[model samples]
Target chain A: MKPTSLLLPLLLACCPTEACEGLVIERAWIREAPPGARVMAGYAELRNDGASTLVVDAVESSGYFDHVMIHETLLEEGRARMVPRDTLEIPPGATLSLAPGGLHLMLMQPVSDLALGAEVPLTLRCGEAVTETRFPVSAAAP
Target chain B: MASTDRSALILLVLVAVLAFALGIHFARRTAPEAGAPVEGMLWPDPPRLESFTLDGADGKPLTEATLRGKWSLLFFGFTHCPDVCPTTLATLRETVKLLEETPDFAQQGQVVLVSVDPARDTPEALAGYVGHFDRNFLAATAPPDRLAALTGQLGILHTRVPLGSGEEYSVDHTASILLIGPGLERLAIFSAPHAAPELAAKIGQIIQFLQDSP
Candidate 1:
């Protein structure tokens, strides 16, 4: 078989669809917790460049944690509550910000200690498209 | 006719002078604008807090008496909380740093965290949790009923939701930080989206107002 024919097949197989093409992760960071701390929070800005809305249904970090949940901290009637979210939608041409004291990822049961400046691989699942990213551990502002 | 006109002019002058003096007197007596940093609603007459006994981080008894002779900023949260609790505590730590720069603020001010999940937040756990933010920070907890006694009076609220397996759970609590006067009275509440320097400035204003009050 010609090399051009082989290359065409490989490109077609890799670019099956545009669902995962335009998703970008920016300023992704995980709050560094003290040694022996079991839980930590992650923040980031997820931007969707596709024409359709991107819905993130699940997240995973294989070597670091077995469970990752999306949660929002709501301040209602002067009370603050952390509510679990099943899915977060990133509208087309818009950015979803996960900031402090707002929407964040609840990372639990760390398998090992996470040090500052270390980058951890994170996989975000949205429908059939899975996007892989890295989260850098950073210290909180004093 | 000339004497009559002169008497009228003298009466008008006297009235004008009396009005000017009254204006100065009222201006001095009027209260100053609140200028609180947190935009909290100030109580014209702060209500005295009811007596309730809770355990302090050091195993000492904490009651209304603990608030006497010092200003305190009280927050309700749990050690297991991953986001809001720690974020608020960090902001407060920064606020304390700003306050310490002001004279007498370091000596007279304190930050206390009251755990809503007393079951999981033992004195030791709370101590470690709060100490991570600041060494001088204090933590406390009470039984459900006793905790209600204080939270209810302050209009603070909290609810626990299970995480669907095992004993794991999360507690939703009031994010507002309450300011307690040196006399153990409830003065104001600092709501969420709090800024460190703004909170510190408000604390200074509140302290000045309290000290200047009769």
Candidate 2:
């Protein structure tokens, strides 16, 4: 679902805090891709700090990339298949990890090359609540 | 006189059968011994590869002869693949380093990145991508049909996945790394979640075992 129309207000409400009230992001990193690479992958840990479950319905990184979507690499029948994830929910007091060779943020069509140590902003929407964080670009996991 | 001829025919048949049995016995004795079981590797019956031609990063033909005389480690992936491809190539780099450090380990091998997405991964782009990981690493690709011919026999599967629209797509591909023997035969299959140390150790042992066999 294209939730950008509604996410704009949520983005305004949240001031791009790394440690927020409901949900917090930790150890976020964007893997540095080779020059002329059209796509890159980002990973982070999504932790639910509040009593209720945090549902991330959509993701956006407009200025840096054409679009961002949650994708998973599944090893099925000896092949790696990229499956898009529309919604992801984290239970209360639980942490969900997006990592290499697993669930990750598939950032497509970068406006320019993301150099090492560069930070890219990303926004996540969970209904009316929104959380934003910046992920540092690195060759390996941070 | 007819009875005498029949006896001679029976004697000739017995001598031929004895020679056949001896040949089987000697051949079995001289066959190579299988190595110990290694993690993440499957040494099925090695199959001879079909002759196929692909263009290397330098626009030269990379045929089966190019892979002869060296152990070839082949991975099928696209340069645009952001997650799994980089992870695998890095793992392979680490694996190669471990192999080099070990003494008596035959380090005669080449790592090749065979692009499944040739439409986007031009020869120059692929060369740059593989070089970022290691300068010695090689990359090659061909037209879709030629690529399919090579991939089909090696059991490498790849398909283009469209992401949204407007000239954006990702490739879903086989994650296993293939080992080609120096004799141009498919040797082993290494499954994913590859650890550098384990992979290097296993490969070193497998190669040594084969060389020392018979």
Candidate 3:
């Protein structure tokens, strides 16, 4: 059976696999950092397409980074601080946009240099479900 | 040449002339009235900064006097900062590019990144970090006490946060960009989130306002 056009538009942005059932990821890209920079940031927009809420508990980039964590850059009392998150909940039909000064993925200890236009595979761990996406390296949001 | 080409050329000239006139008129109109806020929080009586020294990327000592003779945009962050530091620096670079496009605006504002993490961000490291964003950008840092003397006057604050038991730590510092006048006085404070075009426009307006002042 063919999927309707209404559903096709939403699923087009996600990885074309059965595992990406509940969430659709779009505009996923990593900011290109200066040479020898230990840490870089990745931004994306996540949309929960399922009826139930999706909880993203962990993120991993195989063979690309030593560690990956969800972090938010907060402006408090005129100061900038980075806070780590244990989990992120996306309600049904809700969209989460990860931007520069706000929610972002802390890509730490890149195994090698991430040149512009290079694509790195990233996986998100949601309880009983997992989805994968490729984040392209760019100087700005793609 | 064809008659259509001639007509097109004439139209271009008329449009150019009108644009030039309108540009002048709008520039004058945007200049704020006496003692009015230019962009962000414009200080009615901007305070003159005290003398303090920090290590510059050029191996020279950067003092309050070094910021004289031009407008300076100072940002306080660390090299280890993964997100906001680079984001802000890139925006500052764009701001300078935007200002350069204005006619008769010969002197573009200088951007200085003051590293609050002195323990990790040395002068050499500062050079590499800032030079990546912009080669013309100035990077400076000093020991905790010396740095405190300068940041204290500017109302900037910074504190170190430990990450587990490792030596890794992050410094939470002020995110606001400080605008300094040619006379070394605090001009205005531009709080985030910043847009490059608006920042450039506001700085140009402030410069014009100051110049037109008695």
- Measured over all alpha carbons after superposition, the RMSD of each candidate to the real structure, in angstroms, is 8.1, 12.2, 14.2
**Which residue runs does candidate 3 get wrong by more than 4 Å?**
A1-20, B1-41, B102-108
DockQ score of candidate 2? 0.53
TM-score of 3: 0.81
Q: Per-residue lDDT for A92-132 in model 3, tens only?
A: 99999999999999887899988889999999888646799
Report the Cα lDDT for residue B72, model 3: 88
Off by over 4 Å in 1: A1-19, B1-41
Candidate 3 docking category?
A: medium
Per-residue alpha-carbon lDDT of model 2 for B26-135, expressed as tens digits? 98898666574434444455677878888899778888888887888899999889899999998998988888864443356789999999898888999889998888
lDDT of 1 by residue, B48-156 (tens): 9899888898889778888887788999988777888878888899999988766656888889999988888787777777887888998899989988888889988
Which one wins on DockQ?
2
Query: Clash pairs of candidate 3?
Result: none
Instruction: Give all candidates' CA lDDT scores.
Output: 0.84, 0.86, 0.86
